[model samples]
Target: MKKLVVLLSLTVILSACSAQASTNKDSNKDDKEKVSQSSEKKQTSSDVYVPNPQLTDDRSLLEIGQAFKDDKGVSSLKAIKKVNETYRIGDVELIIHDVKVIEHTPSYSMIDYFHGFTHEETFDFVKANIEIKNTSDQPVYFSPIAILESSTGEHRDWEADIYLEELNGELAANGSKKGNVGFILDHSDKEVEWVKIFTSDLLNEEQKVTNKAQEITIEF
Candidate 1:
């Protein structure tokens, strides 16, 4: 009886060791697969173009517009073009609509900007560089990227503001365009999540492309 009991105990231990080894091997394989996938996401070469949204946790929230109804590309811009609709900054239902992507370079595409350098008291200190590209063989221009809004149930369209008005021009067909715009928020009221971009001439009767925006904050 004592010999039989010893044999049984040894068999049980051997079986457990084998099971543990198999589990470890499977886990290691899964980890390697995940690492390979992560590496693939960063492998875009210089010839393939990508746009930039200069965002930071201190001043911005970023979301890819993948759920747009008409998006066809493998990127956020493709999604925005497909959806042909608008979204709210947060739960407040402040609709920002008619989001269009311009082929211009992000450095030059004018958008609603908060000037922090001149008037320190009335603006935000955070600025973003928006880059847009025209991923095609021929040239094209997405002139005046525009969005619409609704106030009191009334429909309105708006554009980005350029202190230099002559800058409102078209991107060449089949080619890419670039532009630079910025925003500045005072440290006291830094909780801005959503912003509206539009073209307006209402400020000085010049009727140029400009921005009319409102601040929506979590704590507000």
Candidate 2:
């Protein structure tokens, strides 16, 4: 009877150890899966692009433009034209810095944003850097580029702009803003010799037109 009792005790001990080992293995597998899922989430989040990102330092419009190109992995960039012209309407001042023609191949992560513009993986576009300021003591509403027409007869309204820099809309008193505006070209090979910009009418706080809209042309 003593020998039988010892044998039973040993059987129970061995069974408990086996069960514990199995439980530990399952817990370790779950931990590994959780860690792998976390890694995948981090990688996916890093692939997303943020538009109109905040600048870390004071960078020129040209420098900002180059950074944008690099961020998007542009295959080719051609500065087909450069312009340094200023237009003033009523209490608002507008300046055009430069224009660039770029060829870009969108990554899989960027496909959704570029889908509306083109179906091709590789596409071309024209981008313009501009600045606007309100010199009055009161706020005013204005848009620097109401309508953009390329020399190849392709036209895009302000609503179609890809660069959502929030450069349009109400301008605070003595406030200034600068950014880029880009439009996809219908034909990548088409030559762009010039682009005509139509500015929106300057409106006061009462929504009354203080100044008529103007047309400005920039040649490459």
- After TM-score superposition, what is the CA distance of residue 8 in candidate 1 from its true location, in Å? 82
Candidate 2's C-alpha runs over 4 A off are: 1-71
lDDT of 2 by residue, 107-200 (tens): 5667788887679888777777776767788867677776788878888766677776656666666665566777888877787778888777
RMSD of each: 27.6, 26.8
lDDT of 1 at 190: 30
Stretches > 4 Å off in candidate 1 = 1-117, 121-123, 135-168, 184-190, 197-220
Decoy 1 TM-score against native: 0.26
The residue-level lDDT of candidate 2 at 145 comes to 77
**What TM-score does each of the candidates earn?**
0.26, 0.68
lDDT of 2 at 90: 94
* Local error of candidate 1 at residue 154 (angstroms): 18
